[model samples]
Target chain A: MSDQMTEGYITEDGRKIGGTLMEMKNITLRFGGVKAITDISFDIKEGEIRAIIGPNGAGKSSMLNVISGFYVPQEGEVWYKGAKRPQMKPYQVAQQGIARTFQNIALFEGMSVLDNVMTGRLNHMKTNMFQQAIWKGKAEKEEVENREVVEKIIDFLEIQSIRKTPVGRLPYGLKKRVELARALAVEPHLLLLDEPMAGMNVEEKEDMSRFILDVNDEFGTTIALIEHDMGVVMDLSDRVVVMDYGKKIGDGTPDEVRNNQDVIDAYLGVSHD
Target chain B: MFYREAGDFKTTYADDNQTFPIKFDRYRYYAVLFFAFLIVPFVINDYWVNAVFMPFLIYSIAAIGLNILVGYCGQVSLGTGGFMAVGAYAVYKLMTAFPEVSIFIHILLAGGVTSLVGVAFGLPSLRIKGFYLAVATLAAQFFLVWLFNKVPWFYNYSASGQISAPERTVFGIAVTGPNTAAWATYLFCLIFVTICALIARNLTRGTTGRKWMAIRDMDIAAEIIGVDPLKSKLSAFAVSSFFIGVSGALFFSVYLGAVEVGEVFGINKSFLVLFMIIIGGLGSIFGSFAGAAFLVLLPVLLKNVLVGMLGWPTDLAAHLEFMIVGALIIIFLIAEPHGLAQLWRVAKEKLRLWPFPH
Candidate 1:
């Protein structure tokens, strides 16, 4: 069952205003009239864990996809940080310090776990091909600097033992952790985690939840995660957003959203016999 | 015990991201290149040069080109032979039209011409991939090879439907053709391969190479990462074709000294290089050279020992060569799809522990 909550983001000034770091204004997305997401207006704040929870067909993934620039909204202005963001590519979004992990484990399976994480440093690596080829000047220095940073991330994720192991051979939970570690490697301003703990076991989920909290507290990274586990969402998120059939059904703090009537109806189905 | 990365040290990123990160690997590579370029020229006689070094270097270049397409970008191209034809014919046409011009420059320029043609064929990869994409490139191979046969101009109106290498040179020293010294031809190929391999390595590690790998790994995800599939895939086609074209020119100039489309550079040549990549390693640069060398030498070694010495029938020896190569392909794919690269890796892994891998 969906949790009872309406969540909104905090303003950039650290105020409790229902303002947002990213405001998806009147977003209408369609997969040829299917209305995958319709007229959805939601804002994610500067420094909070904003969770999006809904039924399977509720288009949570679609909304996340739209935010990350994977899918262009049929009609919407996506306001991020301060000004309205024009439609941009996903790497542009990544360049803007927004990084994400997929619901399914989407890693470079053929590459080592370390190489997979190293790919996250792609945007940060500044040297060109000539520099890399000669390996004498700037490229070598940047590579070392990046490996230092990536090593810290790997250590943080406790994946040092399997650093050189190809991601294909890693267990499901470890793969999920590597995916999170990869997203974290970007040192993002906002982290979008789509079902970060979907297939993780209880112990793995608990470790992931702790890692998620540490990432939020340590880096002060604004996180917008989608979770099917209501309990984990309730325990971890500062605010929650609820959707039903692609529309934002409820938006507040955990307790206020918990008591919203529409939120109640969406989950309990209004109980019409 | 079989695979571990316990004590690999990296004092720098260059150290870590090296073509061969391990100390042992660096030594092995230098040693091999030293042999191939320096020592082998002196040790090998003229017959060995004609039958071995020439084909090996030419095929090595072609394998690296194919590796760029299939290994790095994940595009299967059966049209490598066609690109080679483009190079050979381009050289033939250029030489016929401008007889006074230096032949060496024409051979080099033919690669550029082939690159353009390759990208044109590679355009279909935008819409297709995997087996379907392979089929599309098969079209490129058959079409181009057929064109060389049908159009008499490519053969310079010769009755034999073939083209011979012009007496080409860099500085009046014979650099191509049978009369040229083996050392000159070997040196010419060595320079081009070293440069192309360097370029390929840089492209693979840097922004461009990463873009190709991103597309190769997952096109949809690569798009989300902000890579334009159009630019990335086309660049791969162009770069890959450039190398293939040059190899074609080299095959005509430095090795065969003359070629017919369906004979020297054909679908069979494509298969040979593909097998080289398979036996060497995919997506690893060193694998290209290793595969090329192994595949090229296998038949020669077979003929020398089996047919020449043992008096086995030449036809039987040829069939045996195919059987052994085919079986090796299957074994490499099944046992370690990583190919000789993995074997090299394993050997290095053992050496890292030295004296007591046990």
Candidate 2:
């Protein structure tokens, strides 16, 4: 594993996968007496689509929250880029090259689609209030530069037609796409998506799957997504971690996880004492 | 036909991101500026200046400030009067202490002082929100009013506890105090209004504006997107207070020339500014101006029609004015919560598609 970390590896499809981008070691998150996620550990590698698959109440979302710095685990540290990440505010975590979308859409409904996407570039805009107030040289140049990046993402996501429309007015699938565009605008090294296809139709799901793959292929962004769709997990992810009752039940490549007896038993409703 | 953007094309991001992207709206803005600076100053008399122009311009600044906090930033502050008092008192002290300095500098300095106080008061906003935050700001209103009224230094140890602006000048023309010409006062406030509106507009359309709106729209998402809530909320409070303070300075120095803190900068004044934004439209620069003009004109219109023409009692007209404003606010909230700015936007939308309905 250490040798592979230095040399990298080529997948079956010939895509290069880099060393560990983020590793969660013995993470235990609790809410009062209830453990939302207990003693779960996983690592997401660079340039690979990783999936966290599980049944309802499996703490998949909670694990994603911990990675995004929304929650701090009771035990163990989150190692990112081979360094232990100190517990910080979610915004601070976001500034460290991490971005995410929520289970329910979290678009700023009052603003235009363009404005919503521009917000993803907040970490990049360096102009102060005084410069922005005058808006002549530094502020104007920064705005245009950031606008170019946002526009590229918007074009890539094919949401240019509704650029000026308010986010609240858009349909759910398009809003999800805008959210993705916003997260992509961060140009993050690691993107965590929480239920990207929660309420989509068959066609919408297929489109989302394509976009996820395209994002991974084109930007080489490491993605760790929590998905319920078994087909989507098998097709999109290079490796899978399966969880049930706030515990990791299986972890391997999609084929290995599919054949793991524990994962099958968890899916088949095995009785627990 | 004139309002349409059919022939206009923006070839660059800067052009597309301009305050007024359309040629017609841009021209209209220039026209308004030309008229305000060159036209209105010439024909204005004392009655027009005192009753119409001065209050309109001063309140417009206040409205714009309040709109930044309540309208754009979505932080409901009921402490406009308190913040304004800070400006008024600060200017009063500055004017007396530095009698030789330009009144413009005093006003600007007063705004700076008020921003500090605003930020101090704004600290509570980090932990509280909605009506609870409003209550927090309400405490600021009452406490500030009390401080000004009780403290002798605030009013320069005046026998009546009233702070009055001494005669102050710009380019040898008296712009404050009793001896000033109508045009000097009008142009003085007009200058401040122009600068405030320009700054407000620029800030709201730029990165700062986006941060404020992001926090306003959804705070958790804004945080996760890397917007610092401390910076955004505090900046909103500070900037909002600065404008309110400037207006307060102008209110005492130019508009009224003398003010008692308790009666002038009280709970009622806070509500008045809040109502201006609510009526004018939240989150709109034009709405601030529109709301200010509407409120200022409402009283004059009521006096002329109810008392001047109908020979009704003055007090009755005042009562009727309150009733009309209350009813309009209710109607606006229920029917058009976006206020007059949205109405103007819808009207323009229709004008763009005129002569055909699909």
Give the number of the best model, judged by TM-score: 2
Where is model 2 more than 4 Å wrong at Cα?
A1-7, A271-273
Candidate 1, CAPRI quality class derived from DockQ: acceptable
Q: What is the lDDT of residue B115 in candidate 2?
A: 98
lDDT of 2 by residue, B17-127 (tens): 998888888899999999989998899899999899999999999999999999989999999999999999999999999999999999999999999999999999999
Docking class of 2: high
Candidate 1 retains true contacts at a fraction of 0.31
Candidate with best lDDT: 2
Worst 10 residues of 1 chain B by lDDT: B1-10
- lDDT, residue B109, model 2: 99
Which 10-residue window in model 1 chain A sums to the lowest lDDT? A1-10
